[model samples]
Target: MDFLPPLPLLIAFCGASVLLAVTPGPAVFYIITRSLAQGRRAGLASVAGVALGNLGNALGAALGLAALFAISSIAFTVVKYAGAAYLIYLGIKALRRPAEVRDAALGTADTRRIFRDGFLVALLNPKTAIFFAAFLPQFMSAHGSVVGQSLLLGATFVAIAALTDTIYATAAGTIAPRLRGNKRAGAAGRYVTASAFIGLGLFTALSGSSRAK
Candidate 1:
């Protein structure tokens, strides 16, 4: 497509996306938690939901939602704190749901709900919108349609994320069955996941606005 970046830029983008995708972050934590709790299928579903939500952010960024963040500190702060609160809320839910969790593949994973939550988790994060705004432009060329370029690059990012996220999910799923069978281990596992979520929230809260000014 004419919207696509040049070969050298594509390679650079791919490499950077891959590196970021592999890095354990909030999205990765959510996917991994789902995998260990529900199995690979749920984890993959979560990935799909997250990807869709990210696509939305990419769209929003293209439409100038990100511009608002740059211009208004209040707007950015409100969304940032809100996202952090949501993460902490989800973490609390996981912590409280230990009784529902079982050894089975699904356990209490609730793939459908997980999907929705994953979508919201990604969608609500102003930081993600900001990240894409900052991250995608590095490879863009002035010659292409700016909006088309943004969407193309955003889709590319989602594709890379889906691949790497699935890898994390599958690997976690393999160990899930064994861990879930053991009552103590399963409980412990959920707590760990819960802790990761809460930690991410706290980190996001404290770290604030990673947007490249």
Candidate 2:
């Protein structure tokens, strides 16, 4: 209980999680594409798979993160700034590049296979762990157990992502009829996500600076 983030920080984490979930990313595209191509069932399966994979990433990061922090304040500071830099870099890349969708043809009507693919896609991506390692700590209280906070917060993020991903999968047809081809919409989303990533990175960096001072 002491490890749990305060109510306001929890709310902020939830809001940030939602924004990241809604953004058109590999997992989002995977679920939506599955839904659009196969059906709602496949989409849902994919969501489940991806959720598990993301949770895996979260758990892995959380496990190592606390150990590193305990070992050295210098290591903690290094990771914090490094993560901020990575986020800023991602945002800039998203802005400069057009949004790309995962290949729809890669899946099939077999929900099991689709699920496996989804899980692998998420699990194989190293960036997911890095993002969690970077993003979750921004909201953590310095006074409590870092491991407990990381686990709780990481699970919360995965849950939020699963919910939003399910929405995307269920509404893929209606919301994104031409998601792959719609450069205009992609451009708009790009700008929004870019702004978010940049702002978050800046906030993290600035907050760390303030804490140091």
Candidate 3:
């Protein structure tokens, strides 16, 4: 069972994962808030919860994609194109107006409750699952087992994200204090992330079409 993607695609996936991880999104903001208000311990708990939720999303995406592939190749291709369009839409929406994370009082809760909150936050966001569905297939090798490849790629991505999230959790107190107020920096980050998302969508669509031909 060939589980690993080709070396080049694996490297590309890793690079993309890093870029996505560094982008300040809902998870980042949630972790930062937990760290800022509750401390590193709380932040770490939050990170753990978010990582688990993301893992769930990845696994779900893998299974769902595999099922689609089993049902019909046409169905799978349709899903891939839909996912790409969704990514582009996300990028365009971000460009039009980046999301702002407002300061909210997350009252001091036990680490367990914070963990639960973080888990729920990530789990409930359907976008993450859609993202995994969109992004993982681009790196998959058609010759390999779809489920196996998807699982490996999904786990790899989740691991990278977890490592980056942990770093953010550890450093949030020092770095994030003034970050919320820096509109310029926030907007710049959003623009960069938006461009990356659009580029990824285009790359996926083009590569898929070329492969089809």
Winner by TM-score: 1
lDDT of 2 by residue, 194-213 (tens): 67656656655565322110
Residue 65 miss distance in model 3 (angstroms)? 7.6
- For the record, the alpha-carbon RMSD of candidate 2 to the native fold, in angstroms, is 9.4
157 Cα displacement, candidate 1 (Å)? 0.9
Off by over 4 Å in 3: 65-109, 174-213
Q: Residue by residue across 1-213, what tens digits does model 1's lDDT show? A: 668888899899999998888888878888888788778778888888888888888898987899998899898888778878988997898787736444554655577787898888788778888888999999998788789989989889888988999899899888777775687887777788789789877877778666311
Where does model 1 exceed 4 Å of error?
98-105, 211-213
- Model 2 TM-score (2 dp): 0.61
- List the candidates ranked by TM-score, beginning with the highest: 1, 3, 2
Worst 10 residues of 1 by lDDT: 98-107
Q: Assess every candidate by TM-score.
A: 0.89, 0.61, 0.62
Ten-residue region with minimum lDDT total, candidate 3? 98-107
Steric collisions counted per model: 0, 0, 0
Question: Any residue pairs clashing in model 1, and if so which?
Answer: none
Predicted structure 3, TM vs. truth: 0.62
> Which pairs clash inside model 2?
none
